[model samples]
Target: MTGERARVIVVGAGIAGVACARELAAAGVPVQIRERARVVGGRMASKRFDGRPADIGAAYFTVSDPDFARVVEGWRAAGLAREWTDTFVAYGADGRRAVPGPMRWAAPGGLRSLVTELAAGLPVTVDRLVLGVEPGPSVDGTPCEAVVLAMPGPQAALLLDPALADATRAVQAQQWTSTLSAVLRFPHRRWPDFAGAFVNDHPVLTVLCDDGDRRGDGEPVLVAHTTAEFAGRHLLQPTAAAAGVEEAVRDLIALPEPADHVHVHRWTYAKPAAGLPEAYHLDDDGVGLAGDAFGEPRVQTAWLSGRDLGRALARRLTA
Candidate 1:
């Protein structure tokens, strides 16, 4: 590691963190990213399942903002992203309903591909868990101009400096639930038309995706997501969760044979029901909080939050 003091240290390498880091670096600010995981993407990530990359976290994202749309366009041109579907089926207590014109998008390789592109050329340190933060200076004792906390609310709270936490008390963070995802590989293809399915009021299955159809990969991959209630109950048991999710998906898809392989993933902070109003929360003490928890629980919101924070920090630095 170089003995240089970074102008800003953006914690977490999820969409928010990477977006923030990209914006800050583009503005000519000396920035460093710290990620606890070996990979760069946090929740918008992927894992190898049965010799194929599968998205275990964020399946797809929607773009609404003009700026975000432009970014997606760039990604599309670079062959990193492609449209999944403009419509989706929502399953609820009543029944199944198809909503059109939603414009769901996905990365060609996996959601993590986009994150990797965002992290390109940025100084990212992986597997370094930040236990806590104190109000003082950088490790070298040089006063840090800014610090961006791009982690989930609970995570940020645990790592926040004592004084900063006190000042940001009013920034209430919503209680989140976990999710257990199972990527099941099948011998034969399934779902001829639809790429995904949202199953609600089901005991074990909440969402199921036909990964082959979704990514146009021509492989038999079924990604099953468990209900929040079920996930909370069996979050500790990976094998149990994976089995349950596989069974649920098999039933949902009415498969003739069992899946070849099953892989389970747990998301501690899946989504936030209620979030902070500010796009990016900031304190006069040079600490900022930005994440999907600060807005609607979505990839676009995470990106927007980080972009807003990066721009804010740039303005402050220039001033």
Candidate 2:
């Protein structure tokens, strides 16, 4: 598939990249996705522990946009995704209280499976690291009609050449924060009954998700995301922070038992500190940028950003 004559080359095989490629393909445009990782999914990542999948990246997603809701419906019908919960417990000065909000969705197979589902049959090449994107609007000196960077701005900035001023400036203006996610596997369930919680004003923790509840399997596993400050301190050696994270979780829920195993994952550019007003950026140089950074950091936002960029590129190329 990599040998095909792809007019457009999409860097990053995350949901945004795959969504863009899917739209371009549907519009009869030729595009290919190149990902640095062995598999796609980007921030919506997952890991397996004892044969059970746990969400290690994004805990869950909320639906607001009608178009995105339709997409969610498809996933629900296909049994790739399910409604996890609408209420989450928030911890702060007032203490823990149930906060009702939009319906947050989850996947029984883990959130990554949703991206994998969207990427099926797409011309995606894994382990294909992009070196640079130059003025010819080419990738690694190989020219294409356009290049779509569907990743964090920090990552995309690495590939943009100084000559591509528009793209370079757009990417440079983006600021992102880091995070460390830890998955703790215990012998049995011992935490509270909540499926998820938002940790506010904490120096160590940011969010916690009951992996068992979210996965709909009740496997006695918990996933914790640390604050940017905490993550920054241990970015160099994320595993070392696992002990602190586990302790925070235990204390937060008053658990007496310790986790049998813990695994930590580092996301250097976990999420955009803020987002641009536009859904995506397409410059005259034929270099486009798409990701959650284009809007709020949500699964729907990433998909919409990529989908919009693909449609725009298709129209431009077809014209």
Model 2 TM-score (2 dp): 0.98
lDDT of 2 at 141: 83
Q: Residue-wise lDDT of candidate 2 within 64-124, one digit each (tens)?
A: 9899899899999999999999999999888999999998999999999999999998998
Q: Put down candidate 1 lDDT per residue, 1-319, tens digits, no spaces.
A: 2466788888889989889888888888888888889998888878876556788998789999999999999999999999998876766677667867687898768999899988888899999887766675242233577778787777777776567654257334556767888888888875445678788789888777878877788788888888788888886776777767777776665677888889888887788768777798877777877888877889999999999989989888877
Each candidate: what lDDT?
A: 0.80, 0.92
lDDT for 160 (candidate 1): 65
Model 1 root mean square deviation, Cα atoms: 2.2
- For each candidate in turn, give its C-alpha RMSD to the true structure in angstroms: 2.2, 1.1
